[model samples]
Target: MKKIEIFSHNPVLLKECVEGLEIKPEGTYVDATVGGAGHSIEIARKLESGKLFAFDRDPDAVLVSKKRLSSYPAFVINSNFCEMKKRLESRGIREVDGILIDLGVSSYQLDNPKRGFSYRHDGALDMRMSKQGVTAAEIVNKFSEEELIEILKKYGQERFARSIAANIVKRRSQKLIQTTLDLANIIKFSIPAKFRRNKNPCKKSFQAIRIAVNGELESLEIGLEASFDLLKAGGRLLVITFHSLEDRLVKQKYKIWSRGCVCPPKSPICVCGNVPLAKLVNKKAIRPSDLEIATNPRSKSAKLRILEKL
Candidate 1:
């Protein structure tokens, strides 16, 4: 087996998340998506006797993070965040004091060509965040043009979804699209020559295919709900999302859970007896500072949203 040199990941909005968690010296914490132990290490440092349960679906990430955080005695689980509630229950951990979810592809994954996350890399078109899923190549080559267009429009927010889908189907007819460069080229030709000059013309299509292949957006919807339920009263959840689709889901879920009642105003009194689950700590998403953005261009699109359980 070949050895992979995995680099440490810089958690986006690191300070913001740690502060929002309001870490207590002896409070239990959970890092639902411990990509590279970035925030997990800090959470462990702040804890005197508190325990952190770190979860990640990627085996590569799990191995690296376990090694990086080995000294801290953190419980690292190889599982998706959507199953976090069940996993914690089995571990005899009832409620957590704080939960931090960094919901973006890690730098390590993007940088690794074998992972096929970056359009720059010339590798197999496999964009699975975990080893247990379909690949980007399958989605691009097998999906119907309409299905492809829907993914591009919804996940990527691409304006040329129709044209891109049409071109993909047209190209795949002659040859199988099996690599990052192959798909990138197809996306490039789909757009008119004038639009090709724009920054990252392939970005939208690649993002769309990646999201679909990994079921990322769907998992976010479920994971957000699970995270809210896992928190103990007064416990906080800090989620960092990278794109509009993710940010929108996080915002909408928080708004619903934060609502005081669901009954119509015409009702004389509250019927559902619903209480707010969490309160938004930041009504507006927190963003990276100019200095941070200058240092890490990837942080430019990050948005951090926090909620304290009521």
Candidate 2:
């Protein structure tokens, strides 16, 4: 197994995340997204007789994680967390004391041009987290303009989705969009020069394409369900989301799970007798400290939320 640079991953919210888990020495835990085993390693060390099931869709990550977590009672699986329930069941693990899902792309992936995950360096336009589905090049070169627009708008929330999609279609027709820089250039020129001041012009489009290729949002929805269901009574769920879309999804879902009465507002009586399945550990989402963000800028956008099963 190939090992990654241990220094690559700074483990966003490391202190808050571990403390939020309220780890018991013998309690089982799950690290649903083992980007570089940063969070997984800590979770595993807290366990004595307890087990830690760490998963990642990226084979490279799985390889690196297994090596990093070898010293602890951790099982690194080469699968998406969406399959958490079935995988855990296969391993005879029905419930866990806590689960942590960090929905951020690994720094190693962004830094390695060979993986085709970064626009900063030239590489192929492939962005499959699992390396098992449609590649970004295929989407950019073959997808309809309308399809591209929809993905950019919904996933990336790109303000210039239409212009970007139109540009991709036009550029691809002249010659196939093969590399990250090729698509990045198209995105840069598509947006108005005035609007492209602070942030990288390609950031949103690149993120949208990657999300589409990996089915990331869909996977997160399913993974959240599986993770919540796999928790034992009073077991906590700690989710660290890196963007507004992801953070919103977790916030909305957590709100639903923490709400008590299901009765309609107009209908005063409480007839359904529906009770909350969980309680929010923190009313507001937790953000990284200025100190942490100053050190690891990638963590600036991170938001951590915790919910305990009721």
Candidate 3:
């Protein structure tokens, strides 16, 4: 077993999440995606008597979070954030005052070559956030062209998804695509010259593959709803999303919940009488300042959105 290192992952929009949480000194809170316990530590510090439940799917993250938060009275659970309800129920805890989810791969995962998260590393094509899930290698070699295309198009937002899929199929037929370099090379060859030079061509494909491997986006959507339901009235929910897809999902979900009704514009009377569940605390997402971004480059793409239950 590889010994985990004590490297730091600067949590993006740290102050925003802590503030957005609207932490009550004696109110319980949950850090659903407590990677490295960056935000968890802050929450724990603010709590006088309230408890903190920190969840992480990755064993490595769980281990690291345990070490970081061990000093505080915290319960570190190795579970998917999507299973927030059952996990909390098992603990006999109900109605948390706040929840925070940082929905991005931790610096540890990306930095560790063995995890196979970064295309920069020549690691095995295993991008499972949890040890239990299917790997990127399985999806790349086993999934049909259509499946590959769908993943690339939907998750990656890659314009050349079809070509990438075609190339993957072609290459794997000759040899098993087992490593990061193998797939990265195939993606490089599949894309046009101009496209390859502008940005890391393999970036999107790797992201898509990772998402599929971990079911990350789906989990976020599910976890968001679950967290919403778990919050007590006046309780707050804070989400820090890295990319556009996540931001869009969070935005749409918040909009739906914040709206008074979902009936058509021309509907006679408000037929879908769904009262607003919560109000968007920040109509515009909060972003890290330039100084913070300079100090922690990983914070650059983070967008923080907050909602308070009515």
Candidate 4:
């Protein structure tokens, strides 16, 4: 078998995430999505007696991070961050000083054609981050038109979700959509010619399919709760989300956690007896600087948010 060469990953909002963590030299921390170990390396270097636990569902990422972080006091686990609480607890770690979760596809995943993450690449329609679940091709061919439309509208925010879903069903009836280019062509043709010239019409549909295949949004929801529950009082949880949907979820959750009461506006007394779980580090999401976006185009959509346990 050929060895997979691990490519260097440029971590988005690198300085901001580390600063938000406020790393204590002897404090234990978790790097929930140690893609390419870019952020993990930074977190590990700041440690003296502190330990870093890094998790990644992708086997390729596990191999890369394990080697990259081997020099430091870091332990790399091959698992999804959604199971972080259970995994950390199994290792006798019930609480942590900080947790950093960067929810963006690594540059390596997109740049590598075989990964089938990019529509620009004419590779197999296999967009599994772990390479162990339902593939994009399976979804495109097997899912009902309504199911496809729902994901396209909800996850990708695609305006022409119905049209695109119909086209996918129509095309797959003739033959299986087995490759990224095949699906891209169908989506491109589904949109109006004028709109196709403005941007890649396949972008939204591809994103929607990938998210559905990987259960990304669902995992994010579970992972956020697990991360928050595992943080000790005053410990921080930093997350970097790439799109509006993800940003909105984080924003809403933070709002709920920072609230001191849940009583109805009409009620005079605090009957709910709700207490704030955490306070937001920033009122708004922290976006990448102009230089960071210019240098790394992929960081353009990144929005960072932090909450400290109360």
Task: Look at candidate 4 and tell me the lDDT of residue 219.
Answer: 91
Candidate order (TM-score):
4, 2, 3, 1
How well is each residue in 1-310 modelled by candidate 4, as lDDT tens digits? Answer: 3367657679999999999999999999999999899999999999999999999998888888888898999999999899999999999999999999999688889878798988998899999999997888888999999999999999899999999999999999999999999998888888999888877888888888888888998999999999989999999999999888888888888888989988899998999999998999998889999999999988998999999999
Ranking by lDDT: 4, 3, 2, 1
In model 4, what are the clashing residue pairs, if there are any? none
Please write out the lDDT profile of model 2 over residues 53-139, one tens digit for every residue. Answer: 999998888888888898999999999899999999999999999999999688888887777889899998888878787899998
| Top lDDT model | 4
List the candidates' TM-scores in order: 0.95, 0.96, 0.95, 0.97
> For all candidates, what are the clash counts?
0, 0, 0, 0
Q: Pairs clashing in candidate 1?
A: none
State the local distance difference test value for candidate 4: 0.91
The 10-residue segment with the lowest total lDDT in model 1: 1-10
lDDT of 1 by residue, 18-57 (tens): 8889999899899988988999999999988889999998
State the displacement of the C-alpha of residue 7, model 2, in Å, after optimal TM-score superposition: 7.4
Q: Which ten residues in a row are the worst by lDDT in model 4?
A: 1-10
